[model samples]
Target: MRKIIHVDMDAFFAQVEMRDNPHLQGKAIVVGGNPEERGVVATCSYEARKYGIHSAMPCRTAKQLCPYVQFVRPRFEVYKSVSTQIGEIFKRYTDKVEFLSLDEAFLDVTENKKNMASATYIAREIKSAIWNELYLTGSAGVSYNKFLAKVASDYEKPNGLTVITPDKTQALLDHLPIGKFFLVGKVTAEELKKIGVHYGRDLRNLELSYLVSVFKKRGYLLYDFARGIDEREVECSRVRKSIGAETTFNEDLPLNSEAARQVLKALAEEVSMRVKGRGVWGKNLTLKVKFSDFSQITRSMMTSYPIVEAKDILIYVEQLLNKVDNLDEKVRLLGITLSHLLTDEERLQENISLFEYMESLR
Candidate 1:
């Protein structure tokens, strides 16, 4: 059996803020944008969660929920630096680390550098190191596969560790809520509930054919997960196929209006930041628009050269926007996606910045 450990930082962004400013500890705080500007909550402290605050919640709503809750702008660079430190700690035990995000990762320590026999022990030591060395706490889960390990890690939170051994897997899963199953989102959970599948035991009682008929492609994974069967590997180097950022507006704006253009520019900046952060570049730019009626359309352009900067991305975005026939439509959402990605290694061959390439064109 493979030994996997999933580590997730506890309210990572908020925790980091609290760590830096001692007065913020044990108080309700969030890391995000301004409430008046339709900004969303990126993460909230545990105390803030008591007031029904959560990630992706609008800052205005979070404020309404807890009027005194503190809001701080995101410091992504600082978070990345801390994440690098945490990654170094992971490398001390295992090189088979798969980062899901800056705040969470899965480590396959089946054959670890530390030669630790117990996966649980390794997880405990990792948690301790993060707390003692970094002044931050993390939750860890140990199991034989990625699914269970991830689930176990979430079972407890804000500095807790749980282990799912072979013998205890079935019992724990059988009682697990269907909504709690990995990959089962809100809509899927409601659908399963309608079919009398409220728990893993209920899910397992149904025939595979029935699930497939109901959920189509997703049914297969649900059936396997219900029975504690996952064959996925802990990929050390997972390739991200695309990087994108989007925003949904509180009020719709005319598609061709200046306000829409500004939103698009903001999205381009975000996409550019994320792409550069990953040390990759893209050759394709896709513009996604959702109208007031909830109808959506996407326009894509493939370029001969790498697109890396906000200015370059916006140039293509303007072209894509102009291509749309319904420029007068009121749009509720705008998104930008960069695909046909080239990794850091592949990018070295070109060895030229997008700015320099643009200058050559000039």
Candidate 2:
């Protein structure tokens, strides 16, 4: 059996805000946008959740539910920075890290850099390092596969660490509600209930052919999940297609001016730093602009030579920025992305097919 660990940041966006501002500690904080502007909650603290606040809920409703709740605009740049720090910590233990999102990932530590046999120990150490160095809490779940590891991590909330050993995997799956299964949304759960598949054991009872006829691809996945079997590997061989940095301003910038150019220059510098750090260069440069109205546009230019320096990036980015025809529109977000990348070292590698392996499980 392989060893996999899923690490999820606790209330990522809101938690980052709270960490930076001590006064927000223990207070109900919701990070997204203003309630007056038809904003919605991106994510809220546990305290805010008590008031029936949740991600994707409208900010106006959140305020109505709890009058004193604080709503703040998201600072994505800060969140990205924190995510990078956490990623560095993960790389210390294993190179087989698959980022599910900015806040969560699956790490295959079957053969880890630390030479530690216990995946559970690595999970604990990672959690400790994040807390000590970044002052942020993360939950980890260890199992033989990605599905179980993800479920185990979410079994408990903030700062949770759960391990589902091979022996105990079946028992846990049988008792776990169908709704609790990863990727089972509300509609799917309701449909499952109609078929008397309310739990993992219920799901296990369904015929695979019948499942395939009804749910197609997802059916095969659910059947395997019911049996505590997931053949998917932690895909660490993925390559970065592009590297970019963006900034959303508190105030919108007027079009065709030094303010926009200055912002682009700063973003180019940051993107260049990241590109150089990765020992990679790009042949295409793109400038992304989001207007105050939220509609966005991207202008890109391909160069004969790879861009590795900030000065070269800035030149192309500035040229692309000038190509924007809607100068009358107020720009609220500015970004620069370098694409058509060439890395110093190959990030891609081959893994055995999961389908054949999965057939053995059935």
Candidate 3:
């Protein structure tokens, strides 16, 4: 067996709160809301889900569906801390653990504690440890590879565990919808359905040559996944590509110079904080402006030296203000993004010091 395991926490945030506070048990607990506001749900406890409420639904609509739902705002700092503890647990099983998100990860234990025997055993121990230590439950899926492992893990949810042996692979795949395949998203799934390609079995019957001819680049991917073949690996760690920030306005702007400059300065400050906090510097600055009518535009400029300060980010923002003036349109949202990253060695050679870096570059 290839020995891959996918572990995903069950209602991560809401479960953590329920575990810590006993009184909240057996009640409908939601982890994101302001009750009367327009924000959507982040995650809801299984109790709230009993009323058909799920994550990302509008809070108002969720409340309407389950009127007795107890709304609680998300506490991200707590979630981050809990995620770290869970990551430590996975590290004990294998060094080749890849975190897909705070609540889920994939582990390649081919050369690990179990060592070619049974992958399901390691997954069971990990799930047991999480329940015993953190007072939360998680689901596990074991298979020959990452793709099948992930599919198996979600097959049985909420403290459930499922395994897809090599023998059962074809049978398990026969009934799975094309949409259930990881990369077959909403748009592609609709396209597949239109052509009567609803299940993996249907896709497997279609030859790769014809699929590629019709779909071009994506056709090959469809053929590969249809056979339950995935060449992807688990990357446990990597650097962040970019640091940026965006904020949507409660009302549209009047498109005056005063309004544009004021909004740019505020957005630049938000971007600067993110860049500096990450301790990374950027060489390119891009401004994303969304109009009241939902049209979007982006303009970018490259700086000679990298910047990680509020003052310099504002300078680029000032430069963009002039570029956007001719649009003659009302503004609804403003965002600033920092990209074109530089490594630490490059930063040291360029002499990009913290003190003189911001203002001197201008």
Candidate 4:
């Protein structure tokens, strides 16, 4: 059996803020942009969570939830520096580290450098090292596969470590809430609940054929997950699938209005900058718009040649915006994404000039 360990820092961005400013400890703090500007919460401290605040919640809503909650602008550079420190600790025992984000990673130690027999012991040592070296606490989960390891890590919060041995996997999963399953989001959980599938056991009881018929490809994953099966490897070098940027407006903008067009232009520029920084290009441009009622829609355009410039992206953005069926609705958020990415090397091989590509499209 493969030995995988998943480590996730506790309320990472918030914790970093609290750690740097000792006076902020034990206080309700949120790390994000200005509430007055309709910014969203990146993360909040445990003290703030009591007021039903959560990540991605609008800062305005968070303020209403906790009137006295402190807000701190995020310091991403410092967090990335700290994340690098944590990564060094992981390298001591295993080189098979797969970082999911700045605050969480998966380590495959089936054959570790330490030659340690117990993955549990390695997990403990790594967690201890993080606390000792960086003054940060992380929760770790150890299991035979990535899915269970990730679930076990999240079973407890803050400073926690949980292990899911092969023998204990079944009992724990059978009682696990369907909402807690890895890939089951709020919508999927609600849909499953409507069918009386509230827990893993309920999901396991459903026939595979029935699940596939209803949930399609996702059904296959659900069926396997309910039985504690995840065959995915801990990929050490994860590829960037897309580059995107988005903004939520303080006040809703009329759909397809000049104001909305300006926002799309800004988002396209941001996406373009990021794509160029990463030295990559893409052929697929997607425009995402969220309405005032929280209804969302996305329109995409695929081109024969790669897109790299903001002007090029804006052309498709306007076209996609025009394609929206709900032009009468007001938009609360606007986002632009470029996918079907190709690296600098790959783009060179394509041998297509941006000018020629634009001409072809016209």
Candidate 5:
């Protein structure tokens, strides 16, 4: 059996803010932009969650939920720096680290640097290291495969560790809610309820063909997950396929030439910053526009050279925007995407200063 551990930071952004400023501890705090502005909550503290506040919630709604809640703008650079520190800590045990995001990862420590035979012990040590180095707590879940490891990690939140041994897997999964299982989304959960499938055991009772008929391609994967059988490996060397940023608006923006330009410019800047932060450059720029009718369209351009800077991205963004046919329609969303990426190793060697330039923005 393969030993995998999933590590998830507790309320990452909010926790980091509280760690830096101790006065914010034990208070209902939110990390995002001004509530009065077109801001949304990136993450909120457990105290804030009591008021029904959560990530991706509108800041205004969060404020109404808890009038005393404190809101702070996100510090992406600081968060990225902390993420780098966390990555380094994971590397100390095993090179088999797969980052799900800045705050979560799966580590395959079957053969670790310390030769630790017990996965549970390695998990405890890793959690200890994170706390010692960053003064932040992380939860770890150790199991025989990725699915159970991920499920175990999230079973408890804000600094909890759970282990699902081979013997315990089936019983634990049997009672677990269908929605709690990975990839069984809200829509899928509701669909399962119609057939009296509300838990893992209920799902397992269905014939494989019935599941396949209902969920199509995803049905095969769900069948394996329900039985606690996941053959997927812990891919250590994961590559980002694309980098993009998008905004959902409180009000639709008219497709007037100047109005569209302004939205595209802002989106391009955000995308450029993220691309630079990841040390990647792309040859294709895609402009995605969602109209008031909920219809969406994307226009892309393949450039001769890899693009990274906001100004360069804006140039292509303008070209693509001009290609969009419906100028009179109102837009509800605007996004910029960079594709056909080349990492720092592939292109930065030619221009060392370019990498330095990207870092300087942070």
Candidate 6:
């Protein structure tokens, strides 16, 4: 059995805001995009949870739920620092750490220093360390596989711990709601209910072949999950396939030769740090320009080999800039993308996408 532990930070972004500005603690606070416009809530505090406000909900509706709620913009810098701190804590446990996002990650401590044997202990220690180092609590779920480990984490909220032992799998899964299982996302859960499979027991009793007939390819996956039999490894998912960052200014930027270069340089540096930070290399560089009127155009190029180094990416970005017409006018935003990719010609020649030839990573 693989020793997998899923660590999820509790209300990560909201918690950070609360920590930095203690005045927000114990109040209904939300950190995300604008509410009056087409904005949505990224995260909310426990206090906001009282009003049924959750992440990704339209900010307008969230305001309807709690008019007094405090809304704050996202602080990526602060969150990144906290994420790094949390990652350091995971490294203390094991090197086989797979970060799912800023808030969640998986750690395989099968050959831990202490040979702790129990994944539960590893989860507890990790959660404790997060609180100690970052002044925040994290929920942990430990199990023999990634499926159960992730499910265990969501069983509780805000500083909770749960374990799924091999022997206890059957009984534990029996009563668990189908909605709570991994891969059975919101849409799938509703679909399952329509099919009369509301719990693990219902799905487990389902014939694999019959499921295959109804859900087709996904049926095979449902069958495996029903029995708590997951073969998926704690994949050290790539830092990010491609890194691109964009910003919308409060005002439009002029389209002078110097202004364009200045904007392009800034965007290039920002995107460079994103992709280069992960040590990812790509052959294709794409530039996106959003005009003040919201008209967008993208220019792309394919290099002979991948450009992992930041300077190479920036140079390619500078070259691609020549493709855009300067007389167009002031721009609202500029964006850059470094693709872990190959040219279309290369793909046709190889008869497959770069991913397939690279490995079965996809």
Q: Relative to the true structure, how large is the alpha-carbon lDDT of every model?
A: 0.87, 0.83, 0.79, 0.86, 0.85, 0.77
RMSD of 5: 5.4
Winner of 2 and 3 under lDDT: 2
lDDT value, candidate 6, whole model = 0.77
Give the per-residue lDDT of model 4 (tens digit) for 1-362: 99999999999888999989999999999887577855567789999999999976768889999999999987766876798898999999989998876788999999999899999999999999999888889999999999999999998887999999989999999999999998798879999999999999999999999999999998899999999999999898765788888888999999868878766766665676456544568889998989999989899989667888778998888788789888878989988999988865678777656657768999
Best by lDDT: 1
Q: Which is the leading candidate under TM-score?
A: 1
Model 1 spans with C-alpha error above 4 angstroms: 213-216, 243-285, 289-296, 302-319, 329-362
Which regions in candidate 2 have their CA more than 4 angstroms from the true location? 237-362
TM-score of each: 0.81, 0.67, 0.71, 0.78, 0.77, 0.68
Query: TM-score of predicted model 2?
Result: 0.67
**TM-score, prediction 4:** 0.78
Q: Taking the tens digit of each residue's C-alpha lDDT, what string does model 2 give over 1-362? A: 79999999999988999999999999999886567744556789999999899975667788999999988777766776788899999999998998765688899999999999999999999999999999999999999999999989998998999999889989999999999997698779999999898999999999999989989998899889999989998887554689887878899988677877766766665676456544457888888889999999989899756777767987887677678888877899998899887643331211133445667899
Q: Please, what are the lDDT tens digits per residue for candidate 6 over residues 1-24?
A: 689999988888889999999999
Flag regions of model 4 displaced more than 4 Å.
240-285, 289-297, 301-326, 329-362
Question: Residue 57 of candidate 2: its Cα lDDT?
Answer: 65
Tens-place lDDT digits, model 3, residues 1-362: 46899998998888888887789888898876465744456688999999999865667778999998988866656776788899899988789988765688899988885464678888899999998888889999998888898898889889989998878888778789888997787768898889899999998999999889987977887787778787778887643577676667788875555766665665565565445434457989998888998988888899867887667988887787678764567788788899976655668867746546666778
Off by over 4 Å in 6: 239-362
> In candidate 1, what are the lDDT values of residues 1-362, reduced to their tens digit?
89999999999989999999999999999887678865667789999999999876667899999999999987777887898899999999988998776788999999999888999999999999999999999999999999999989999997989999989988999999998898798778998899798999999999999889988977898889988999889888776789888888999999999889877866776676566555568989999999999999999999667888778999999889888999998999999999988865676666567557878998
Off by over 4 Å in 5: 190-196, 213-216, 240-298, 301-322, 327-362
Alpha-carbon RMSD to native, per candidate:
4.0, 12.7, 6.7, 6.0, 5.4, 10.9
Error of 3 at 336 (Å): 11
